[model samples]
Target: MANLSLDSDELLLPRDVVAVDVPASWGGEVSHQLTFAGPLGPILALPGRRTRWLFLARWDTRPHTPPPDVRYWRDRVPAPTAHWVVRPGDALPLVSVIRCAIRTVRP
Candidate 1:
């Protein structure tokens, strides 16, 4: 597992999971991108607004290669990957997303 420190919270993520800054064009309002080297593919997390943040997960059987310059491989990527919008002040949804990513990793 990898230790990811966000503010005062530290998240244990899969060792192959990597987070990078998301470009304004692709991220829209998000701050970072989480790329899993597994079937889970990429999971984009938007910055928290006054009430909530968004978590977008994409499933792909093929390996994920992060686009150069923080751009997505294709513009249409977001359309099909718009999977979930976590409710305000809810950490459970985020946990679930993390779990899914973790599960995709192979020992």
Candidate 2:
């Protein structure tokens, strides 16, 4: 929703990963995207509700390739953040950690 400030600690280097804490109401799984224009410049998205989210960290594969973790979010998950780094030879799409919850909490 806003520009992702890239600090020294949050620097997304090559082959690294970061997770974004999305809200349950968002109904993730529609592949949400986190993009960086330049050095924490302009972060953009479709600006609409989605059914999914993606994790760019595990670019090689999704759902199965990466650990079972990044696929979903914890109930007390943190806030969403963007990550970017230079890939030596391949291209990896932006990724976002989709939030999920147990049906017991449904209103």
Candidate 3:
């Protein structure tokens, strides 16, 4: 099992969500099993590849706090809360996708 932290300033706001594109193989298996961890606890497991967009957000408990939302590639999607880790699995490599996305964002 892998552990991810969601206590970063970048994820403090409700709208601060990260969108990760999870690619699947022809067999419908993913290269990794992701686990998201928030300040409270584990948010949710990777929902099967219904949508290529893996939306992520930070867990907020403020009253009436709006949910996390993102606009990627001209599409808007709701995001789940927290940090994530990629576990070993069979299929396409998702870590590379995530790393690439992060790299594009920072510097």
Q: Against the true structure, whose lDDT is highest?
A: 1
Candidates' lDDT values, in order? Answer: 0.31, 0.28, 0.29
Candidate 3 local distance difference test against the native = 0.29
| lDDT for each residue of candidate 1 in 28-57, tens digit (9 for 90 to 100) | 223222233222323334333222222333
**Predicted candidate 2 versus true structure: per-residue lDDT over 12-92, tens digit per residue:** 333333333223333232222222221221211212254222222222334433222223322222224423222222433
Q: How close is candidate 3 to the true structure, as a TM-score?
A: 0.23
Show where candidate 1 strays beyond 4 Å.
1-4, 7-16, 29-61, 71-107
- The regions of model 2 sitting more than 4 angstroms off are 1-15, 29-92, 95-107
Best by TM-score: 1
- What TM-score, computed on C-alpha atoms, does each candidate reach? 0.24, 0.20, 0.23
TM-score, structure 1 vs. true: 0.24
The positional error of residue 56 in candidate 1, measured at the CA in angstroms, is: 9.0
Q: Residue 73's C-alpha lDDT in candidate 2?
A: 27
Model 2 error, position 5 (Å): 26
Model 2's lDDT to the true fold?
A: 0.28
